[model samples]
Target chain A: MSEIELDLISHLSEYKRIFSFLTAEDIMKKELITLTPENYLSEARVIMRDKRISGIPIVDKEGKLVGLVSTERIIRALEEGIISNKIKEYMTPREKIVYFSPKDTFEKIVETFERYRYGRYPVIDEHNKLLGLITKHDILRAILKQFHSIYIHDRRREEYLNREVSILASDKFIEDKASFRYDINTQSISEAGEGTALLKKVLEKRGYHRDFIRRVSIGTYEAEVNVVIHAGGKGLILAFFEEDGVVVFVRDWGPGIEDIDLAMKEGFSTAPDHIRELGFGAGMGLPNMRRAADRLVILSQSGKGTRVEMVFNLKEGRD
Target chain B: MKLKEVMNTLEAKIYTGEELLEREISFGCASDMISDILALAKPGSLLLTGIIAPQIIRIAKILDLSGIVIVRGKEPMEETIAKAKEERVPLLGTKFLLFDACGKLYEKGLRGT
Candidate 1:
């Protein structure tokens, strides 16, 4: 689904492939109960009740997902006596909805569900076509299906697989490693660095030294700002806590940097004059990231996207 | 210097974090470019900038700055005020130009980081 997947897969161990190879498309329910934007909340309420489903995806005539109306919205509309209103007025808009691509790995979907705490997420294609819906039950069923093929006769192995998959699905692994991941909304330039700010707060609460948090947050902020300024307004920020350091990744599906070497040079910027007016695009984003982190590697393809991985060692003092 | 003293030095107005006026700040940095601020700013320093975007509030929270002094008496956007209130980052406004405000703070024995 993505070229970057192979690069990461090649680096992971053999056992990790089991989880990485399986994706949302493989597990998501193809048959879905969906509604159109023109549908009324009264109609949606009756459909949801008859189908016994808590939520439904709202799509256009072209089958592109436009919104989602959950049971909570249904109750709110009923309370407000607006049950007869159109579904668009009562649905969570597409811009705010957390969705998954068909090609996304199971681990990514699990992590997203854990982060957003949503009951279910719509699976869509690159064209925004509503492909399917994924839920926690779907994830568990996928794990079961995997185990059924391999450990059908081995009860012990089945137990181990169950334990492992649950660990992967829940926040247990993240809590143990202190990994923090967030989706960066690049649509608004003013909301940049929010993930980094939250990271700073978490590190502070965990008793990290002020300078250590500052270095990590500074590096993360620069990378995130790049996503907002250059990237087409969608990015992901993931930080994995190591024993003596931290690893952060900022990935954006933007036009990849044509020449990373030139981009790394101080004061080299491709940003236009309008962006410069907002106090960004000074050509210092990469250099600042380099200065703040102990090690920085930027992986990018011309037409695909750019992924910046920064490593910070706690034992090392500031440069 | 206490943040209150810096507020007095610039004859500034507080937009948020009024309860944090008693906090001590040692250094001051001024910049219109956020990258420079993130690259060069030190922890516990005061940030003086001509910008009032919401990202400034986030940067202040990340850098653990003592406060932000919006130079040139510019009105911060409503979203910026909301973010500052949420992040609890002290935000103040000043009528003096960026250069004069920095000079006044320097004259008062507040050094740069």
Candidate 2:
């Protein structure tokens, strides 16, 4: 059983406690069925069949999730008559797959399933470390368990789950001062918005002004995108929500900026051709990120890493 | 103003979510970029754009925009229409360009939030 389930089963007597704070970390598959890049496709196919799963998470020697081999990849491999190929030869690169982390809200999971309509997603940590696996079934099952037992079998339980849970963040779960961290992978457009999107909900639930949230969202997004587009290695975003506003720090273990002054100038870009082809790396990210934040400070060590700290102060009243 | 009046003013075709035409809207924002829409536009504002892709609908849904108007008589692809229907965002097509759509909506008392 997952930790959350254990917590729930133990807390059955006091089930009136907030069950909606439940997140992906509570039930993700800890004993993950994963594959290494060097693994053979035929062996992977057999393991997936035996496990009754349609996809296999691919990890690196460091146990970090580097790619995935889905049933679609399997079919494509068979179509090319290369069942003997290595997992890396057929797996979807890490940058392309849509994934969520353990801290992600159940609402975000539902939105992802509805938006992308994918069957399953690998659950990883901020460092690209594979933690567990999650599917639509897993989410629905966990959420359903949160009801009835907690609310004394009332119609309001149905209304709360059906209406408020889906439409907005649970107002009952708001905390004034909270913090969280997220790991960002390289080159994954799908995962680029994860941190910013999740942060928006935190700010929204606290009744932060829309324009304040927008500035935070915009600043966080550009920082996230910069990590994916240029950070040769992985990155991390640390978010702190205080009583007045929020502070975000984006740090990456990639080749740091050789010239901070030049990089900050609008329309000055060093992004390669393929990244440009993707319609990003237009040299505007740093400037935009700066423009959206109330206070922006950048610290970098060339050939080492870059750290950007941004502050968003709330207005006296709603904007 | 209700979306139907905006549709009439722009002479647009309803591509999806016809039932939502009765929904009221306050502001209009014109942009072809999803990032711009996501970062700038307010929820319940009208999105006037030339880019008619599934992504536009996704942005509108994420930002909780009131509806969309695909400009220059262009139609959103079938896939885009299907996603818009699922997302419950009304889609309108207008022969008028993006600037004209924004201008007319502005004259009618709409402003970007």
Candidate 3:
């Protein structure tokens, strides 16, 4: 097995109880209102409105949960012009339910929620009697805790991309003949890498050929990766493909780089020590971008942000 | 060679895409780096990777890879497998390490074009 696979396996095994850790009885709201199958549609609506709730469980005369009535069903009924006063006409008879015992863990709850994508789950006792409701908000809080753990675990990964890359100056190059005008936001460079890939796909979808797409992908990938790794999470990238070429604009909100000459030096990287351990920040990001792009420009203001624009010309009638 | 031949050569298990065993793959690249695979691998090539990320299937979609071989007994996440199925990309798993798996295919005359 590769080291990465082993690492992933270990990680999965370590977090086996992620769902269990997030579920608990306290997260459920026990003050649930019940309705009968014979209740009027308007009556259910009034109860929902008064209770400030979107749904209510339907119970039989024995107080056993039998169905569910929600706002969506009411809207559908209105759309279908169903003026029937019976709750049975609108309630979901075969509703999905989630039941949790006192011994059930938070990880299981999270797993169930993610698998089902349900807004709410009803917790029940050993006898399968509904005791309370656990809404999506409770699961979201648990997921947020997982995010926090991941963020802390990857702090070094975050710090590597928190520096500034120099922005080269450029005269405004705008084209009026383009089909679409895309305003590049260079302020959020962390997203540039993924954005560039998306832009290339967008161009190809519009009938750009393989070679032009490849060139744009290469240029955008390097520029965006640089923005993410060096711009301190404060760079923006905007791109649009035109009839003649692809235009890319990148901006950053870091301390303006002092020496473009030194910064662009082939192997010069100001990446912090921890970034090197992760196998990135070798300073080739900018040079690679320069090599791939046809025209490159940079603009910067100290303590504000840097903007870098690049254009890749395509062969006319080559689509 | 056919996909069944490749599977037999490597002693791979078919996780899904069983009906696609007759599909032909002329070449393969074994890499865990998704970016490298996206930038380097050719269309219709078989991908051998130990990395189990959703992006693996996403890259396959973008590049139009024929199949994915998750080596080292690694299984893709459920969502990733579902995507492969949706895209009609054959997925296989094997207990061999990446290098050994690639070497076995290379020895069987599956050249990287």
For candidate 1 chain B, the 10 contiguous residues with the lowest summed lDDT are B55-64
For candidate 2, the per-residue lDDT at A109 reads: 60
Q: What is the TM-score of candidate 1? A: 0.59
Tell me which of candidates 2 and 3 scores higher on lDDT: 2
Q: Which digits, one per residue and each the tens of the lDDT, describe model 1 over residues A1-319?
A: 1345333333333234345557899879989988998999999999989999889999999999999999889999999999999998779999999999989986677567545667789999999999999876677677665542221111234555555332122222343353798888757788777788778878788887788888898999998888988897789888887787777878899987887778877889998787788888878998888888866767665666777777777874642
Higher-DockQ candidate of 1 and 3 = 1
lDDT (tens digit, per residue) of candidate 3 on A135-175: 65554454544442221111123443374321221223344
Whose DockQ is greatest here?
Answer: 1
Worst 10 residues of 3 chain A by lDDT: A148-157
Model 2 ranges with Cα > 4 A deviation? A1-178, A186-191, A267-284, B34-43, B52-64, B73-88, B107-109
Instruction: For residues B24-55, write the lDDT of model 2, one tens digit per residue.
Output: 99778887655556556777889998776565
Per-model TM-score, in order, reads: 0.59, 0.49, 0.46
- The per-model DockQ list reads 0.53, 0.05, 0.03
Q: List the candidate numbers ranked by DockQ, top first.
A: 1, 2, 3
Minimal lDDT window, size 10, model 2 chain A? A147-156
Estimate, for each residue in B1-113, the C-alpha lDDT of model 1 and write its tens digit.
99999999999999998899999998999999988888888889899999888888888888878899999999998998998998789999999999999999999999895
